[model samples]
Target: MSRRGQRLTHLELLERLVSFDTESSKPNLALMDVVCDYLEGWDVPFVRVPNAAGDKAAVFATIGPMVDGGIVLSGHTDVVPVAGQAWTTDPFALRIADGRAYGRGAVDMKGFCALALAAVPDALAADLRRPIHILLSYDEETTCLGVADTIARFGADLPRPGAVIVGEPTGMEVADAHKSIVTYHTTVHGHEAHSAKPMLGANAVMAAADLVSELNRIADAMIARGDASGRFDPPATTVHVGTIAGGTARNILPKVCTFHWEFRGLPDLDMGEIPALFAAKVAAVTRERLNRYGEFGRIETVEEVAVPGLAPEPGSEAERLALRLAGRNHTISVPYATEAGRFQEAGIPTVVCGPGSIDQAHQPDEYITLAALDSGAGFMRRLIGECGAP
Candidate 1:
């Protein structure tokens, strides 16, 4: 197809993709359908890796010959929610104006997916010895749960990639490093009693508040110590309490309290240390309360998310390929986590490079410029040329 034809196809496909409200919490099978149909129409061979519940799927497609050295273009199908966000345009409908496309996930991800899908015909038409693979997964906005499963299938049910490029919002730059994230969901248990006899009951909310304070102190200490490589903005592993809820009524002692917290740590940081400290604190509180309430007060914590971050490897195959495609020579690190780390951990050389700006992501009135879309399309063209069919 001509460049003009490709532009139309890209825009049309993006509009279609933006139509699906594939938020992280909802099932993304419908969005996968759009991708499957597009690949089918292009005669591209693809596989759908469905979750156990059959409510979600990850897609892996290949164009050109089934070769050993294949390049993987990866992106997530699920997006962040737009429930309370204020939007001038429909969050699910693509609106074009002033050389930009406005919609949720347009900049955060779907834009890259659309570009990769739109490039299929060109890739198919190119004469290439190596294959170009498209890997799209769900639930990236939540905990990268979808891509984690997809990686599990690689080299077993799926082909092992020589190099993987995660198309996160990078403004078309080669991103080499990012921070790892670990999340915890904590619950405090106590005995309920009348407000007049507070001494008879354990205070779950108070215990939870103390735990949160301890976490904050730990976070402060990390920041003060400062990690050796201060590439991250905060320059330290940070902990934060995201949400908390507990008390039922003002007059009664609450029986349960719960909160979710997260830690974004540098690659070199010992991940076990933070959790260990938290556990010790919980044990101390439990032991102290046991003497008074006799098992009425205790705490439990569950690891919610542990997304490993991408570490930059100087002159790695993934970085070199991304730089060539992006026409850049320098690489940078991001504070956000992506599936690139998971791929790298699996022994596949991986980099995060894609169009659009992270600044536009997860915000109200999110939009991607026409120039960014065109840039991504150009990158795809280069990738296709690099993977010419035999």
Candidate 2:
């Protein structure tokens, strides 16, 4: 395809992709259908790694030699929900104006997906020495486990790639490090009693408040410790509470309270450290607050989501290749969590480099500029040259 043709095809694919309402809570099989069909039209072989429930899937396709030492281009198909956002146009409909393409996933990921798909013909025409694999997964906005099943297949039923480039909205910067995210839900169980009753029952709401306060103290400590490498923007591993619910009436001691909390850890921070501190606080809260009157209350916590961080691999293949292709000399760290960590955990060197700014992602009118898209296309072309016949 000519340059114009490629640009047109990229926009067309982005339009088609953004049409599907593949929110994190919804199934993305429909969007996968369009992707699979496009690959099929080019006679490209791919596999679908479906979730355990079979409602969603991750598609993996290889272009050129399917042997080892290939590069993997990874992107997620799911976008955040648009139900509560105020949009100037339909969130699912692609709109182009002012040199920007607007839609829910256009920048957050679908832009990179479009660029990779558009390069399929170019990759095939290169008759490359090594392969270029494209992986599209689900649930990145929520669990980030959509690629787990597919990653598990590497070196078993699938060919392992030499490096991975996760196409997150990094504005074409090569990101070698990112934070890890772990979410949790805590529930305080207490006995209900009349407000006038003293030493008769434990108050769940009060106990939950104490726990939240403890978390605040822990968050302060993390802030003081700061990021050792001084690469992160916030400069610290941070903790937050998203929601809290409890208490039926003002006159009665609440029987149950629940809250959702999470921590985004710096790459060097121990993953177990936050949980251990929170557990100790929970124990103390249960003993001193929840069950002060008797053994009338208890606290329980469940780990909900755990997404690992991407540590800096200064001289790794992914960093070197991505920086070279992106026309850059230095690497930066993103505060967001991405599936690149999953690839890193699988012993694959991985980096995050893609089009569009993270600022445009998850907003009411998410967009990717034409200039950024063009730059991404150039990057793809250079990648083809690297793996092409030499």
Candidate 3:
């Protein structure tokens, strides 16, 4: 590690990383550059996969020799926005209060990333037989774009890791499966007239309300018929409408209404059915309205993002290796989604284990306990030793 004293302390690294404000809406190039410099200092060869806009990028660094099967240490570089969060201190500045490092990404992530970087020196100094890959991705908070690029590189330009550990905030718990996230933005178009002349104009808000009711019905039905996999909480898919916008004035009929909704699906649940059901409901509702109005009304659903869920594969090498390395006999399921599923879908075996508690993630004044950091560091040390890195 660092001769200065086993690299920087976790809090120190957290402070530096938190100061960068790598929010999902903004570019993370500055933070990526800093990480690149640290890797280069250790003589690690890395490649940059920049986004099409060239504003943000993912950094992939390989330690040990290039090989067919290695371990990929993955973490997202982005943090959620601090907008409207009632923080006691600056959200971008790490504040240690009551034995906690309070900051936007201290618990959600960045802490794990910092710990991985801190362990880099130790990994670099070891004699290694197989490679240890550091996979830092960007835009994970936005749409899971960065990990997708990293996964696409596997077995082609990139050496596919035998196992991938997604370092999300899971309190060092080994998560084998989680729900998938699918977000949709829907718009409804209707003719507008004076509110007093309700008969003369189609009401967009009314149509949106009908659609939302249908969504709720669909969600209830899914819950009643739970998925076969009993791993997930609620044991089924869940749908929620998060945001809605419509009329500008109470006196005027709304011409357009829009809403954002999402669904978290169990691993075995098919997401395609959700939209299809909604579409069928919308078609029926709109057909009735069109027949009444002698005109057509429009309802459009646009997919904002879709993140797949991790399906438990029995006798999978990924799970077997993770259990062996983590010294755990069983795998647990998490409610949150990670890049693990994306990696698994790319034909790469993946597991989820990391520092910090999911309870602290995305909350005001978030923190990762020092004990979590220590445990994660130890995990990395063992991983490097097992990989035969010197």
TM-score top scorer: 2
List clashing residue pairs in candidate 3: 125-390, 126-389, 126-390, 127-389, 127-390, 128-388, 128-389, 128-390, 129-388
Tens digit of per-residue lDDT, candidate 3, span 1-390: 233334666667778888898889899999888788777777788999999999999999998888769888899989888888888888888887666777888877898888778777777778678888889898888788787776788888888788888989776777889989999999988878888877777788888898999999988998899877777787889999999999878988788899999999988877788989999988976776522465746788899999998988766777787677677888889998888889988888788888889998887777877777788877887787787733
Per-residue CA lDDT of candidate 2, range 121-225, in tens? 899899989999999999999989999999999998889999999999888899999999999999999999998994789899999999899899999999999
Q: Which sections of candidate 3 miss by over 4 Å? A: 1-11, 194-199, 248-252
Model 1, residue 388: what's the lDDT? 78
Q: Which stretches of candidate 2 lie over 4 Å from their true place?
A: 1-8
lDDT of 1 by residue, 56-102 (tens): 99999988776666899999988898989999979999999999999
**What are the models' TM-scores?**
0.93, 0.97, 0.93
Q: What is the C-alpha lDDT of each candidate?
A: 0.86, 0.93, 0.83
Ranked by lDDT from best down, the candidates are 2, 1, 3
Q: When superposed on Cα atoms, how far off is each prediction in RMSD?
A: 2.8, 2.3, 2.4
Residue 96, model 1: Cα distance from true site in angstroms: 1.2
TM-score between model 1 and native: 0.93
Error of 2 at 314 (Å): 0.8
